[model samples]
Target: MENSTIVPKSSLDFLTQLKENNNKPWFETNKPKYLIELNHIENFAGALLHELSKTDVLETASGKKSVYRIYRDIRFSKDKTPFKTFWGGSYTRATKERRGGYYFHIEAGNSFFAGGFWGPNAADLKRIRTEFAHDTEPMQKILSSKSFVSNFGTLQGEQLKTAPKGFDVNHEAIDLLRYKQFLVIKRFTDDEVLSPNFLEQALETFKNMRPFFDYMSEVLTTDINGASVL
Candidate 1:
């Protein structure tokens, strides 16, 4: 970091060290260190929000509103760790409706930023698939764009083995229609985050991927503003 970075070396060190000692006793003893790291993450989220606001409207883009808690929900998980070994956050709309959003994860060696809606419910999934059936061109353009592909590689997450219900097997966009989740991600090394130009890289990554997010946002948006036919 030339001057200073929101996420410094110590933040990464804290998380990496925590992985070895992931018990309450260790955590209780090192709570101050954890809080400092968490604060750094919060500041980083705020900085990202500022960058995104220039291109898009992040309705709920504050640190407190967007940062995720470190506490793990081990209710039904196999690895029942008491806390997380990473610091994370999101920049998204305030509404409960499913839509595209931004995510940031900072761990020891696994720093990354991911965007797009993940695992929408049955109804939302139906809506997205229905939109694809009507006109695949819009999403196709986004998927095939040079910048989009370069940044995110391709749409990711689980996909169905066959065509989804209500969509024909022989449909023109059958390949895309088989997708159950619409997501993309960009990974970074710990050194990358610690670089002097990390913030610039972060902003550019988000900007490059904004078009895809906008496309998915349009797909999931449900507004009933038209005059009632009835």
Candidate 2:
């Protein structure tokens, strides 16, 4: 029952309790514990924000903007759980207009640091695919680097069954072109998340993602139709 957590040690205990009692009354009773962990995450978010700002990735970063709600949107779900078992958040680009950035997530057993251009719109996807089609080397260099591959296995996302209309089936970068979303993750275990060095490790992982983000920035920040289209 003692928490010497400097930066969000773990909500694992509370989450386990929530999973067992997944009801309003139980949650109401445990509100204080939830708030304590929530504040821990807020502090973690603030530290992450500072780290990101150092690299100019997050412009006007705020812990409030970076942290996500613990409650789940259960309106249309079959399970209909009122609260989530984890906490997470996103750090948008310093430009504010840029569409893709970084994400931090913490769950009982599935903690990870993720980032990239997730689910880009049709127009944005086309632009990026076109860029890859013409010059795949730049993006390929980043994805294939030792640090990138070690930190993030690969560009993880949904892909189309067939190639887009403008590209041929035999195109060299067809695989990259077929991607509908560009997301990547670096996972961590429960012990790792609670470690004193967790913040340092998280920041380093984020640093490695810079090249990939920089590549996306070219398209996402390009002035198209008089506005930046992520």
Candidate 3:
């Protein structure tokens, strides 16, 4: 196992170059450099996974599997950039019972770690909304806890302008009911990303997400009666 746990300077430098020369020709010429950086990132991810698995089960098979492709699909977008200028990835929790996911992004000035339900299907959305409508205290407690506040600051994601159909606009939990997505994010500076203990710090930050994750997981896996759905 590779012992180095820091994000290499070369990786960031290469990404900076890639941002300037995002065309196919420039990328083709610099493929070897990219590969080297990718390897380092893969190893870093692998190490992170190894630590993460000690506390949580993950569906992602390996660090390499968690890394997102640098390629950008521009099939219908105005921004025709062929490649991403940063390293990004995610890990999904294993099994139906475990809800939420973890994500990491490494970039020059905009690196962050985030986890939550980016998208909940119609059924899941309704379920979460119903739970919040009935009782927002549980979720509220998790969001307001000191660790949660210190780490992520607050819950974030898209929200409806008004109440959903069948939900009263003046509902007590209307703020919670308006959510279209659920996410929490923590940012890090470039210097922090390159630090030796960044891996451990990342793990701790992820650990702080457990209260929110566990709450959501329980809400998701059980029906309104609190019986197991899976």
Candidate 4:
């Protein structure tokens, strides 16, 4: 796979293979191919992150951290994938833990790249929900923007104060379980509508919303929104 330019076809397939053959021995067998794919995925994700940051709409979180971790935890799940082929995006500032960033998942006619809170664990989700509550007005305003609507469809602001139907938001061990990452997971149908140029337009829209995140970061720290909360 290293010398080949196309690389492996499906990320799901790679994961499935890893899960099928459990044990260090199996991993060692596929180590070379896995490393190559991992490198490719990292390069692509890094490029996308850099591109978004250059626009001033998004800022890459920095500091001592890891990029493109290929480890997979399948302890509870019946299906196990030893490693992941695709690299998800993440960012953090100096000395800060890599809590939230950006991630792009591509699927057949269902491609979406998410920004905002990307925490898969409990504490991160709580903090994001709290932030959302504190800055609900501005968050809604950003959601209502023409750009956001055009790309992701209408969004409803759900307060984290209440527990979701299947989720135990109040469970003592709730913080231990992984939760959805983004406060907002903008979804787009992979149709004729989602061309390269269309994605570029969406990126610009997200860039436009970057100020909202910066504003919310401050507002979350200080419960005051100055004059206009929105």
Best by lDDT: 3
Q: Sort by TM-score, best first.
A: 3, 2, 1, 4
Using TM-score as the measure, the top candidate is 3
Q: What does the lDDT come to for candidate 1?
A: 0.79
The residue-by-residue lDDT of candidate 4 on 1-230, one tens digit each, is 24212223443355556656655788898888666656655544454455666654334443112254667677997756555434344554222322234545544445455556543455445544555543456656766787767655643223344553354565543332223443445655545223435445445645654654565455434434343322
Model 4 / residue 93 / CA error / Å? 5.5
Q: lDDT of all predictions, in order shown?
A: 0.79, 0.80, 0.93, 0.49
Candidate 4 Cα misplacement greater than 4 A, ranges: 1-24, 57-66, 74-81, 84-86, 93-100, 105-111, 118-137, 154-182, 187-211, 225-230
Model 4 clashing residue pairs (backbone)? 19-80, 61-92, 62-92, 62-93, 109-190
Clashing pairs in 1: none
Candidate 2 residue pairs in clash (backbone atoms < 3 Å): 59-94
Clashes of each: 0, 1, 0, 5
| Lowest summed lDDT window (length 10), candidate 4 | 92-101
lDDT of 1 at 31: 96
Give lDDT: candidate 1, residue 177: 89
lDDT of 3 by residue, 71-169 (tens): 999999899989999999999999998999999999988899999999899999999999998889999999889999999998999999999988999
Regions of model 3 farther than 4 Å from truth: none
